[model samples]
Target chain A: MHISPTPQDFLDQSLLLIQARPKTTRITTTYSTTSPSLRAKKTALWLAKKGKPTPPTTTTISPPTPTTAPTTPQQHTAHLTLKTYDPVSGTTIQFVTREIRDVGRLVGVLGRAARGMGGVKTQPDTVMSDAPVPTPTPTPTPNQAVLHVAEADVPRVGSPAPTAARIGTPGPGGEKQQQQHQQQAGGSGGAQGKGKKKKGKK
Target chain B: MHQQLLSNEEFFQKLGLLFATTTKQELGSVFLTQKRLTPYDQNPEKSDTKPQEDTLADLALAETPGPVLVRATNGASKQNRDTKKIKFSTLIEPDAVDAFYVRYAEVCKSGMTALKKKNRRRKNKKKASKATKTEGASA
Candidate 1:
């Protein structure tokens, strides 16, 4: 009769079996497809969402937590392929990058591309300068009435009456003319209420 | 055959690191791929026509946690037989990633809501047509 394998032999075999099994699987995929405008809109929208409070329901959509996975500090190359079609050329172009920073750049470029800025060679400063800046104009609300003040007739420090600023040519003579004209109009218009009583007395 | 040299564990770990750095430092990558496809290719059984690549379905954004990948495709080229490959790599500033993540949840929510609304509209249209058909038959 042949001798059977010992407990140590069984343990050793188990260890070997554990070592033989593959530790990791091949590729996992996550992908989305949308028009350039929609992508840009999403990007812009997401950006705007940063400062605002995120709802609890949104927790469902948050990416899966990586902490659950076993990980170690190591460097590995990932094949990131990005393809876009050139309408002018009638061909599709695929871009690949391993650098994380490069991916960020690609996104920036994609975002720009989404905004209808066709690929043109330009420096960062130049690109920024070229983009149109949206300046907000102060529009008067329906409830609010803007008091118009003429520049030429603005009240002087010593001279005590409030008047519209003189709007014409800037000069001492021009200012004086405006002031005189304003005084005549004021004198005529002031013949009301208290002013009427004072004029009658005079 | 092993196309990528890195071990799966190591590769995943690196990907984890990529996400970590990206999320923490607010820097991420964008990957893009574009391919040509025909209109009949989507449902070959339904259309008994040759794949001429007439319809273009370009631009797909892969939902990877590490980096954003935009895959762009266009209709087939009649004259050009060879596929074009473009590899553009550069370092991106932090702002882009920040914007992406900030709006990520909202965009996903809105997209889902929009899809739901579209389905609802379709259902309503179908129901209304059915009711009108029944009424017409009775009359």
Candidate 2:
């Protein structure tokens, strides 16, 4: 039941982040910072003749609502862009609009590559065999995250857990969740422990 | 009401017959495999003749099919049968282990060849294993 982050959350979170900012000069972590998907994309793009600098990778693509036109990635299309008041007072950090389609395409490609890795790519007929079983959904996402997002040199998978915003300590019951999680194991995994105890009692 | 009741009876009888036919079709391979492998049917009339004929040839072929397991009064006699139905499946035991491994290796080689086109890095695997990425190029 992990709900994806909606558009408004991005704006709200950005505002909150800006508000919390000190008058600190943000050292722009250049594209040089390690990120696999970004490097892979750049490498792949360069390999494909797309050239250097893959889309300035974003942790979130706030699904644009009807009103906002769009934001472009530094290299590709960025759906939602965030530029803060420059670290210095009175100056602004501005980024050119990026294309959404580019980011989406790369995300899709990387997701596919990450998904198909290992001996995990079952033949279509084999996949059909698992259709009757209720368990295959969770099997793919985590591996995708681990390989692409968490892997060293490219932390594309390090982007927030796609389900982090909704089923979290974010809503009204945030504290209650924190308490329950701490009392148990913490988080979605901990949430299952309660069911385990109930079943154990039964 | 009397006419409807008669129709219902006729319909149920037809449905039952249809079910029997479909079940045979669905489980036909499984039943044939069982018949060939299991000796519970010492009574020849109970077993189908086609499977018995194929079972011997099936065993002698490249892969041995499943054994017909029987509960004998004294002990069981298992004649290793060659098979066609479950050729891709059917685990190999110790007796046929070496032969199975050789066949399996060939199959693996063929599988690798088929995968070659889509396998981005297979040829590079040898070099990739010895590959080092200069460790800190960006640094």
Candidate 3:
């Protein structure tokens, strides 16, 4: 027997479907060259026709609803992707952009309504199965020896120990440095004077 | 319009004359002969000796011989009331007359910058001299 549906039943269903629509879509073909404002205005216009009060605006434009999709900002995103969202029409927006991670998160929240043979309760494991496995973190072995070595390695920290061989009038650091320089100059001159007389003189 | 209240064009012209004078001139005769303006003046009592103070009708005939549009221009002073000049133009059209004003403003700005630099140099020299004097005194 063919069953007739009531008008209330049809309207309620339509409203439900409209509410379920996703808000944005991605296009794989990159159009980053185009103005983002224009694309957003166009999307806002499309949404406005679907009973939204106003279309999206370019400069700090308010979204029709709290869950409005944010336009892709700067940074190279997934290319050659197409995502279409229609919150009012209940369209499942396709996203070709690599911001797929966001879509996966949404899906995670609202999992498949029915699954298995006779609609079994969704297990946490099933929902997590689609999620990317996080890389296991290795136990950080703090090198106690390395910490000591690093503390010892700071060149500025070990600066207090100036050799007696480095003392003289300085602009603060001059005393330590001038003595070292004078000793080096004296030693070098003695070596050179001895060599010059013995070797080149003959 | 003047001493006669509405018929003395001579006196009205004299009023305009006093207004245009370079030096402030007093018209004791006009104020003294003029009857104090009052509602009773319009009662036809006429004070028997005088009529009334200057009304809209009288002043219109006073300031202007014919059709005169009262306008304030040339930054008319409020303290110097009882006289006004007429202006009929937006005069400062950006495209037409403002270019000279803009250029003049730019010149003024450049002059200001030069003056500031000169002042700064003078200040630096003064400070240096003061510093030298202090150092010599200390020594």
Q: Please write out the lDDT profile of model 3 over residues B1-139, one tens digit for every residue.
A: 1112232233333334332331122211111010112132354445323423423333332222111111112223479656453222111221222232333233222221111122434555666667677768888
**Model 1 lDDT, residue A129, Cα:** 85
The whole-model lDDT of each prediction reads 0.34, 0.31, 0.32
Arrange candidates, best DockQ first.
1, 2, 3
Q: Which stretches of candidate 3 lie over 4 Å from their true place?
A: A1-202, B1-90, B94-101, B106-139
- What is the per-residue lDDT of model 3 for residues A1-202, given as tens digits with 9 covering 90 to 100? 1111432332233223222321111111111122344446677888778877673244564432222233222222112122222222234322222232233322221121101101222347766788889999666467866776786656555477545425532455776587889999999999999998899768
DockQ, all models: 0.03, 0.01, 0.00
**lDDT, candidate 1, at B117:** 24
Candidate rank order under lDDT: 1, 3, 2
Ranking of candidates on TM-score, top first: 1, 2, 3
Local error of candidate 3 at residue B48 (angstroms): 44
Report the lDDT tens digits of candidate 2 across residue range B29-124.
111000112233365444345655543433342132232111101011246323212111132222333343344233322321211133334434
* Best by the TM-score measure: 1
Cα error, candidate 2, residue A35 (Å): 32
